[model samples]
Target chain A: MDTSVRSKGTLKLMIVDDSNIIRRRIERSQQIARLEVVGAASNGRAAVEMFRRTQPDVVTMDLTMPEMDGIECVEELIAINSEVLILVVSALADKATAVEAIEKGANGFLCKPFTDRQLNDALEELLSEA
Target chain B: MFKEAEIRTFIEGTTNYFETSAQQSATVGSPYLVTDGNPGAYEYTGVIGVTGARKGVVYFTAPRGMLTVLLMRMQETDTSDENIKDLVGEVANTISGNARRDFGKNFVISVPVVIAHDLEKVTTPHSRSFVIPINWRTHSAKLVVCLE
Candidate 1:
């Protein structure tokens, strides 16, 4: 009945990935959750650029991308803002990869082929920590 | 050489990916003997390198339409050709990751690799591979695997 998170300020978020499809998916899904999309970036470099500009509350990032990879992106983003919630949205096929993201200051991971419930769960998991 | 529980998990997890990602259910069927025929009718081969106890490949091959559908699921939307390549690589990775859970936490999984082609490309080194017959609702395909 009350899906609107009830937070006075919206969940300002950013999505960085090489695929427009994935961006659109996160966009549409978060639209239902009503998260405010600060903006989107096509690659890691753009992600860093937008991060500096928007300083979003959360970032849904992909591990593999052009101009830079997700791991590298996390490394850079971490240096700038260690407090930001960076949830990896990736197709990395190994637990180590997931572990790697977390080790690199990422807040959590969002495995590919995830359901909307999963997306929400990971989001809530990170948000709950906040 | 997979235990019943392990194989069951592989089947269920991979099937879940197909259902939510591919928007189709995998139809259970006979074991597709990889040595008997080809992988599928794809213009590219979706592969993830395997190492540690088992060293080989988890490969996926299918037509663009079928592959496109699977890719769309992975990326979570209908995309153009530029995105399709990325989606294929990611889907292959996701499937292998799902299957990796069956190997328990002892084995290793590498990054997904995409080789554009329609021919059967063998993963050599004389390693033993497992062939999982994946049925997609009405259609079926072979998931070629090996354990070093």
Candidate 2:
């Protein structure tokens, strides 16, 4: 696991979702988790490319996107860097997919319409497990 | 035809989405079945197709006023037409996604299709649509579910 970014005191985060509203919401709520959003992507394809470029410490992913869904993105992200922490923040309510994501290397999963407090708590838990 | 449980699930999804995403509570009115056209015509609508174990369509319709307030509550200062359309689609997607928890993997929701006007003409015909009225912050919108 890459602890260098977390050890630096401020984690570099990336938000990936198809909806602009969702991406902006996560960006606005980053303060709750004390993280810096270094990058964002609207689709999985863009997310993969951005992940390679930004190499953020953590990534918030949304499933059911247009270009590339979250499941595929998670696989690609983990393949690229097994150390990177991926938190699935998606509107998908399927437990099967959530479990699949974990099996595919996602560190955590959170449903949509979450509060800032909930978001902060999830991030804290993910980081703690790291 | 739609099952009572299915309708209840959709209502819960709509309520949860509003409360969490917009920080606004929503009241769901009685659900009624409609067969010819949309229950109530609106300026904007977000439609999503459901496939897999069940085949159907779901949508969220709202007037410009309601959509504007929703956008503003979402921290969007620019309630432009484009933003309103985007907001509507996101709301519908969130609601449908939430329902998947109750419906299980059998419910597969597609990406949202946003309609700015003339929803009645494009709405699916023959299928029975359950129209549920939702009131939020004095503004009103409708959640329509049509299944095969």
Candidate 3:
């Protein structure tokens, strides 16, 4: 992924995580990466709702949520807009679930406890692809 | 029975979660086997059940002060009891999830169940737990792993 391209035009992004701390961390990291966090949700249900309302360019989703899991949300979002870019940012890093999510239509995956650089790179890679 | 490598993975996960997520460096003390008795007491605890190849439980316990500091650093102004409980569960979930990389798909971890208070009686009778002492910024916590 090319990290040098500093496209200042704010890329609307949505962060989905059950933990308030994780969401805050992602929001803070996105600010550093020059990505605009237009929406934040604690679960997949909220994620889909917010995605429709915000129409974000990219989404960072977390699996194992209470209401709806990230894989289902990925499918829902893809159904809503086939071109939507969804990145699974989850603590559950198992390859089985990762492959399942990809099959469900997630654009990429980033495991939890990620650094700012990793988050930025994933977002940038997703954005570049889009 | 739990393997040494599995214990090491859980320890590494705990340390990494604190350092990376909360920006707090966690130093793990010597791990002792807990055949009986509780793994100390704390204001909050996060317990998760593991299925598949490993069938048992994993938990993280910490005081309110430590969790409050963590929440503050995480940019949360509301350090209420509910949020603190939620933070503890999230921490445990992240740690267990990190360990999944080493344990693979067979080590299926469930969502965390947060408990606020009376953690002294909590015990896994079926398996001996390895209680790992973790200290972060003058506050202390424990990561308990019991598997069969």
| Top candidate (lDDT) | 2
Best by DockQ: 2
TM-score between candidate 2 and the true structure: 0.93
Compared with the true structure, the alpha-carbon lDDT of candidate 3 equals 0.82
Q: How well does candidate 2 score on lDDT at residue A44?
A: 98
For candidate 3, write residues B48-139 as lDDT tens digits.
Answer: 88999989888899999999998887667889888898889988898888887888878888888887887655666464688889999999
Ranking by DockQ: 2, 3, 1
TM-score of each candidate?
A: 0.73, 0.93, 0.88
- DockQ by candidate, in order: 0.35, 0.70, 0.54
True contacts kept of each: 0.43, 0.65, 0.63
Model 3 per-residue lDDT tens digits across residues A1-130: 4322234356678888888777877787664354678989999899889988998777889997878888888999999987777889988877888898989998799988777778888887877776
| C-alpha RMSD (angstroms) for model 3 | 3.8
Query: Which stretches of candidate 1 lie above 4 Å from their native place?
Result: A1-8, A18-20, A32-34, A38-46, A64-72, A91-100, B1-9, B32-41, B68-79, B102-108, B120-128
Q: Among all windows of ten consecutive residues in candidate 3 chain B, which has the lowest summed lDDT?
A: B119-128
Model 3's TM-score against the true structure: 0.88
For B1-148, candidate 2 gives per-residue lDDT tens digits of: 4576669988888889889877888999998988665566578989888998778788899999998888778777777787788888888888888888988877898989998877555476445688999998888889988877
lDDT of 2 by residue, A1-130 (tens): 5455456577779999988877887788766445788999999999999999998889999988898999999999999989888999977888987899999999999998788778878888888877
TM-score (0 to 1) for chain B of model 2 = 0.92
Model 1 - which docking category? acceptable
What is the C-alpha lDDT profile of model 1 across B32-136, one tens digit per residue? 334433434356566767777656667765556666666555554555666666566666666766664456444556655666653655353333445667666
